[model samples]
Target: MDDARRTAAAPPAGPGTGPGTGPSVGLDIGGTKTLAVLLDAAGEVVAQARLATERGPQGVVAGAARAVRGVTRQAGLTPADLGGVGVGVPGLVDPGPGTVRHAVNVGVDGAPLHLSRLLGAELGGLPVGVENDLNVAALGAAHLALAEDGPGEGDAAGVDLAFLALGTGLAAGLVLDGRLRRGVGGAAGEIGHVPVDPAGPLCPCGQRGCLELYASGTAVAALWPARTGRPAPVELFEAAAAGAPGAAEARDRYASAVAAAVRMLVLAVDVPAVVLGGGVAQLGEPLLVAVRDALARESAGSGFLSSLHLPERVRLAPGRVPVGAVGAAVVGRRAARPAPAAGDPRPAVDHQPA
Candidate 1:
């Protein structure tokens, strides 16, 4: 794939019009790397690649531009010969302003993303769109989480959705009444740093005991120190599965923290199904079963919630882990649209950034 990536399409030239040709570009700027994919209107990946993120905003932007250009070349298309270019980042993004208020890994803080400008300067005026990664994941889950046409059709249709990303950081996105909520500051779904343990450990937010302190991928790495440790998280989970006592303790600690976080989510967002994603969520059924059990017991006002048809079923997302990026594409191509009609349940995803 690496060698094959050497051959791809060039992003569209300027701004051109034609029949729908799928999202012109979809870039997911991850903490560790910047990833971009080009797809046709049919949601098929024409080209894709990942670039190692260097330090500072300039480096990040340059690396990202290279990725966008590289993938575009692979697809034999220009930026103008397609739909919108959607990007999903890792920080508190002010979608209205395109300002990444602060980003730990991407080396951006209060930086204006003027993606249109980036596209103009970097890709010859390609129409670019942006969104936060976690929100994109929720959008991704909302669309694909629905059961394929089946006997449970009505039940699936009426279901509300939510998702949590338990990766390096903790964050969630909520889709209510069949719509994505970007919230006032565009951080509505970000409660990961709400201090679940005030007196416990210090959080990346300069505070102590943030929910993420106990539940995120970072937390897992911290909790199970690498060298002196039995092994890293992946190995630890394996050991736990094999009935290693030490691994069991580590797993329980992780589960307990996740349970507390899950309880908070159940109470705050009354969605029907909570889909878990991200690196840590890859534990699959073990994580879900633990979370489900915790919610059944620790979730407050359980009886009341059960009465209100709340405490939605907790489940794992249906697709591959990278679905979050796909969600980001949806955010650009569909979810960012206007609100649905009063009684309409399907999302009205037409607002593809004018």
Candidate 2:
């Protein structure tokens, strides 16, 4: 039940004008922890907080509500001052009804949990939006890509980026021509479950040789102990770096699997950039270099693959910020905006490459 809070002073700004005019809160709910960030109108983070996630649907909602309140209080604001709250859940979500269809890692599954309504109630009916965590994290990563490269806001218009998260599990967030693409069933970017080996380890999703079993942090941590008598994935990496027997080969296989995933994404969607993220992405440049080297090997053997220049397209999520939380904040801010009428002309889809 312990919680931690941190605050930072925002530059002088006047009170927000309406539901979509003020600061917003973004919460990233993971299997092990929940992170909340308060972002002002211009997207600068004003305060942040973290807490252990509670088990079950109701506990998850309560923990999130507490996180929101704690961060706002730290920032010297209140729910009334917020534009809205956005949450990124690590599971299936039907955003239309603000329901979480399943989030097994957090103990929610089989039944729809009305997450937004519960969160709104906690915030005195302030607007709330819930979406797949990877999707929003992709949004945040795309925004960072745009900011790093040039001037336009990273909304669905200016950035075409793919975010590959290598966390406890693996998945992707796709931002194409400025829009987040959640396929028909909201499962467009579930790349981790893509079958890669006919006889690989079994995935919780009832498949063998899924990519996550080989590339995710969970997978690496699990495999390292069995193969090298190591207790942690980090130690395995360290051992590999020191040229320990069998470690380098294992590391290479993991990297190759990840590279294969990236190649599949680029070949299918033609995105210009792939941003590597998630907890495992903390491996940073070494991981990126391994992926790059693997891609290079593949491309050297196939001209078609080389034509895509996959190596140059890969980038790491920016190391300086909490991208998932900031992205959830962005989603929350957008949710607070008035929806466009049915007959209104929608923004034209951008066709530019990432």
Query: What TM-score does each of the candidates earn?
Result: 0.75, 0.88
**How many residue pairs collide in each prediction?**
18, 3
Question: What lDDT score belongs to each candidate, Candidate 1 first?
Answer: 0.63, 0.80
Q: Encode model 2's per-residue lDDT on 1-354: one tens digit a residue.
A: 258545344543334688677888889998888888888776667787778888798899899988988888777787888888999997778776789976998999988899999989988998898888898788778656665644343444657788999987888988877778888877788899999987987789999999988878887776577455543556667778999898888788878888988988998798999999987788788888888998998899888898989999998998776788877887787778788688854332221112
Q: Candidate 2 clashing pairs?
A: 156-178, 156-179, 157-178
Clashes of 2: 3
lDDT of model number 2? 0.80
lDDT of 2 at 180: 80
Could you tell me the lDDT of residue 239 within candidate 1? 74
lDDT of 1: 0.63
| Candidate 2 lDDT score at position 256 | 86
RMSD in order of candidates: 5.5, 3.5
